[model samples]
Target: MTKLRQFSRNLAKNGLLFNLFILSNLILSGCTSSTQPTYPKESIDQAIQDICKKEYKTDVKVKLVGSTLWIYLPIPEGIVEKSNKPEKFIERFVIEQNNNELKDEIVSVNYLIKPVPEQEKLQDMKYSKAAFDRINNVWKVLRRVIFSMEHPEQNSPKFFVTVTADTKNGFLIKEIFYYPDFKKVSYELMSWGEYQHRAIQETEVSPKIIGDTQGLNLKYSDISFEDFILQQIQHRIRLKFQKPEAEKNADIDKEILKIIRYTLKAYGFKDFSTLELNNLATVRKITLNQTAVFSGSGD
Candidate 1:
């Protein structure tokens, strides 16, 4: 019995010593690991780069486009021609920096439309002209409505101007982001005929009609050019990322455009014109001039 006890005591002592040794080893390793410090900006850029490298396609290229760092995932060259009509198209992802700080991220995407392209000569002139006129008419009406919303004092008609656009028609719009300087950063969509604009005042929701309101009638100067750019980019991203199920049921493209107009209340852009181009040939040069109403109510 004495011998048995001595053996058990020896085992216990050895086990305790082993545990202590392990604990000391762990502490020393942790101290050694703490020697290196992490870099903030390098860490951020590396994380982003790693993520893009793993996930996006091979054709998707990343580059610093101007002040913005862009991940350009261009549509395939073959896909550009009208043969296989893809439902949705992935364009590119953009990251903007402000004062060397991450400003915003934008993903530009497009919807797939029908109407196959013919390699042969152009279609009948009369048919083409009529189609062009129809599209132009819708574009003109939209511009007028947006203009009216930006300028509330511009003769409020008996009825609110009906906001309309070609729902079935495929169009593109661009959104940009910048921070800090108002003059430096401006978000504008490049797509012609597709735009969002809202009335300066909520004519539908008047103060007298809804009596629950206190006297906090703060009017903001219409959307700034900087804010305008962000909203446009947001609109495009939502459409691209929207769930497949939801996109099928909803006019996601149109919904996204409307969201931009309503979200920022960009009731300032008025009287804009753009050149119409043939889809077959690439457009070399295009310029657009838009007049937007300026206000300092918010300031």
Candidate 2:
């Protein structure tokens, strides 16, 4: 009788363990199946092209980088030449895509349309490849550094900067910056609720500021100190300028360095020696002597 009772208990224990093993296997399989790529690359590419062409009347080249898709559209030479407003492109596209069907299909999307040289010709202006290249390199690095600092745990963050130049009115330059919307991510639970890791979409975080000939004369009150620091790091000056013709005799690279020195001096940084200019752009990492306060009024 005692032996039989022991055997019964052992069998029940083994049955419970076996059932748990089966349940766990099922759960693991479900998770794996859920993660399998459901969106085909070809379908996404086709959809983006079709939607962009039909809606915006523009042809786009699609490139898939990891889970995000990049849509590159060349600016129409006519539009860039005639319009003094390149900032309109940023505003128009954001509104167009807000309720579009494409937004639902993709985890993230980046639309890039850098100004073309043909547009410069239309404005009777010459293209400064050297100047533009320097600007591009600086903006790229600045964006990367800032994003990494902000989201240290995030492995891959979607972001891009669009630089547009309009020499029609004293060498106007517009920069449109975009990044993934991190603010929407939720971290709260109810009494009888389950937890979830919410997904977020790309959004425009910074204001689209246009830098022109007047950018050289920007005052301390015109821009926030923090933003000023970033612009210096990116080599993007928001001050107004006189004219490209005035700068024709000046060495742009040297002028940029002078501006950096002047700006740092205003911020009360005596150690200007720490500032370094690489082959492409100005790069610096400095710790302030005091806590810097960013003004609310400046762009």
Candidate 3:
């Protein structure tokens, strides 16, 4: 009876161990689902976004060969011109995949070159190439991204830059843009920050100006310094965004008027007697013909 009990006990122990092993295997397999996140698409898209933030001194040369793209951007030396003191020239390379295939769809866009300036002596240049790269280098990249986002349908692949070795330690990049159907798009320098600051400024008194003075005929002497600072900052921010006159051509005066009126209303003005924007180019003035009336939900 004792021997039979021992055999049964050993068999029960083996059976429990076997059950635990099977349970662990089942749990691990359950974790392996097809819905889990993976790379390839997301990672590549992030890489492209990063490329748009880099700066090149002279120009970046890009070429598409089958699945791979080549990028050659220059790295400028601190060799500034005899007179020009603030800028150094450098180049950078970036690549984007054109074909949809993932097989061998690798991009090689990591090269730099330096462009020499047209000066006999590289003496008076004080700032280094790193300094120029720090300041104005990313502007071109930002412009390209803006252009791509703005004119997606109209832009074609032929619109790119090509770089090659020139004599005398210099290089040249031929700007080109090609379509998938082989149509060519002429290269043009994109205008960046063209509409950056274009708005009208409005002036208004703050509620703090009439804080405890309860009367329709409040004095301007009651206005506080805090109110003054707030108004000044608001005015400056508006002026900083004011559009250039040339951009306002083509009789869009109605649109401009609407914007100005909306801005005034937002700044807590009720009824204005008159509002006139002066096109007097010599003065650059905004003359109000009359004062504003009031009465609204404010206490």
Candidate 4:
């Protein structure tokens, strides 16, 4: 039998408030990638470095370790701010429903609302000009480089996008994401709201030399790809409760169930017997078995 879904309970404090956060994950897939690209892995760094320096006038550090591509960019100073980010566009809701015991209960749900660029304030956008440009540059450079290789994968299955936010304090903003998720929105394979829901971020205060060659001062965290995905889902959920927007009047239960359903199905994770969700605010806990989670599977 494979490993089971494990749970570790802890209380998180935010200013004057402390909410019990439930953080647990079940990874059903293998830790390693099934297929590594055919590209010459050694030349990857050189190609990215040359492109960054010559084309963007910015020196970038890139490494393709296993299936994940790690890129660090020292974008223009204001790309990342030194303050807390606004958590808008994520809606939460609750509704009444009856369970199998013939009793009425409340179900909670949260959704990542779509961004209306026209009506959205500058603060609402995910990236500042410099941040967006630098990330786009990385994507562009990778595509150019991969085009020269035989049978390019066209995208990185997993990637780490790290940017230097504050030089004085050595603040770094790191986001781990699945590259093709952007395409999913375009292809209508997933909703724009679903795409926006991704969240595996590390706004670390790691001290490091600024403008140094290849981010030599930065250290690579030895984290597994599956762990990253779990963290992504956990953080995304945490944000919904942390800094929420207007509460929508929908079935929060179904909303959350849909989120979990999409994520689990996408990754082929089905080994878990039960999923646990706890609310420290109310001292309430709900455990849903695999049958309830994937309710349609029996049919």
Candidate 5:
């Protein structure tokens, strides 16, 4: 009887060990299967292309670059030929991965609309070197004058504007505004294209203002000053370019200079010299010669 009891106890212990081992194996198998994601790349690509075609009414090139998917929509020649309004067609493209049941698989999606290239006949038109040079000179003058007015105490505020030709468009202008300590205050991009000459955008980095007044009176408060100057510059350029063929390309420098001076006067600064393309660097020293003459209130 004692031998039989010992045998039964041994059998029960072995059976328990075997059951525990099997349970552990099943648990590990389940974890491994769940951790692996099953995402069909081809299916996702096809889905995106189909959606884009339906939305834009045009075909798009879909490319998966690493974790990000880039959808390139070339501006359809038919659309451009039929419609002259580019802004109307420039709709913001948003792709919701969760709605498409791809939130767990795809990392990011990008929509890139290619710029409309000038027609072959239009491309044959020779770019005006003289016009480009004049525009560039005026831009430099504007930059120098604005820098001087903004930082009267600092000498040679390191301001620069670069104008370059765009292959598809016309001209690209990049302007940089710098601080007295030689750091960048703001950067702006303006495009002088065949269709439009306008301010594209401006980006600025917030500067750490060191002063006793803590919360309200910060340097960021005067951030709009740069934007105001840029807007005036763009406005003058746009007026020059957007005029009728007979009035277009009329002496831009004189008009731009007059506008700048009038704007400065309105803002209570009269000592600023009229910006001349040749004498841009000469106006490094600026003085506030008057107080607020116009209250900017309409009668």
Candidate 6:
């Protein structure tokens, strides 16, 4: 009887252990669902929209082009930005402005660069507090959707651009955010505040065509971040000194150095070894070494 009773107890213990093992396996499988289909098999854009609609109670337009993902956010209320520094045109006078006797032509130039934020602190009273949250939330959704994909599309986007459109006013703002830097933010290697700051700087509060020129393609491909930055430097120079009547074109050259140094210093980008600034209109170029930029001397 004692032996039979001991056998029954052992059996019960073994059964309990087996049941626990099965339960754990089920739990483990449930956790592995992160690799599972996060969205429908139909399309990624649909998945993003559905998830955003469910999560934020909002609507967003998403388009995935070759190697790029574009998200357009609609704002019924127009974006109101603070005033920018007035452009100072060079005062030049020529009897025959179109004469071939001129050494350099003071033609208008268009830049192929997207604008970035000057500095967060400098942007006091610049943008709405809600704008930051709106931008960051959409970005977080994009990150989550991309990372959760077990198998991405063949084009698998490497670049992410978000555009905010004021539906009422028909004004649009485009921003390109670097994915590697965003991954750093996700991994906690970088702070969220810093990440958001970079994102803010990556957009334009007021974007006008090259020297406000017409017939220029406003939508441009920024091949790299450095290309974007260099274009920004060129654009700032062009906008600040748009005047054909400058006392000296050399002042534009000097302003180029000042703007480059100032803008680069403010943005905190230190990777490049050299930069060649080109005046697309004039075909003139200014080349600077890395040392020349961070040498701690006045521009």
**Model 5 TM-score, 2 decimals:** 0.21
**In candidate 3, residue 179 scores what lDDT?**
28
Worst 10 residues of 4 by lDDT: 1-10
Residue lDDT tens for model 3, 150-261: 2334432222222221211232121121222111111212111211121111212223322221222222122222232233323222222221121213223233333444
State the displacement of the C-alpha of residue 185, model 3, in Å, after optimal TM-score superposition: 20
Worst 10 residues of 6 by lDDT: 94-103
The residue pairs that clash in candidate 5, if any, are none
lDDT of 3: 0.27
List lDDT for all candidates, in order.
Answer: 0.25, 0.28, 0.27, 0.46, 0.28, 0.45
Q: Which residue pairs clash in candidate 6?
A: 89-243, 90-245, 90-246, 91-245, 91-246, 92-245, 92-246, 117-201
TM for candidate 1 is 0.20
Candidate 5 off by > 4 Å: 1-227, 242-246, 270-274, 279-299
Clashes of 2: 9
Question: Per-prediction TM-score, please?
Answer: 0.20, 0.25, 0.19, 0.59, 0.21, 0.45
TM-score winner, 1 or 5: 5
Ranking by TM-score: 4, 6, 2, 5, 1, 3
lDDT of 6 by residue, 25-103 (tens): 3333443324435543237667777776798765677766655566766655443343264222222321111111111
Q: Between prediction 3 and prediction 4, which has the larger TM-score?
A: 4
lDDT of 5 by residue, 1-299 (tens): 23223322222111222212322333334322122222344343354455445643434343443332332322211100111321111112111110001122221111111123222211112223432333333333232333334223333323222222121221222222223211121121211131122222221122221121121211121223334444544443333322211133334334443444454553443332222222122222222212321232211
- In candidate 6, how many Å is residue 130 off? 6.0
- Write candidate 1's Cα lDDT for 170-209 as tens digits: 1111112222211111112221112211111111212221
Q: List the residue pairs that clash in candidate 2.
A: 213-240, 213-241, 214-239, 214-240, 214-241, 215-239, 215-240, 215-241, 216-239
RMSD to the hidden true structure, all candidates: 30.9, 27.9, 32.5, 13.1, 32.6, 22.6
Pairs in clash, predicted candidate 4: 108-252, 108-253, 109-252
For model 6, the stretches where C-alpha displacement exceeds 4 angstroms are: 1-42, 79-133, 151-156, 191-275, 278-299
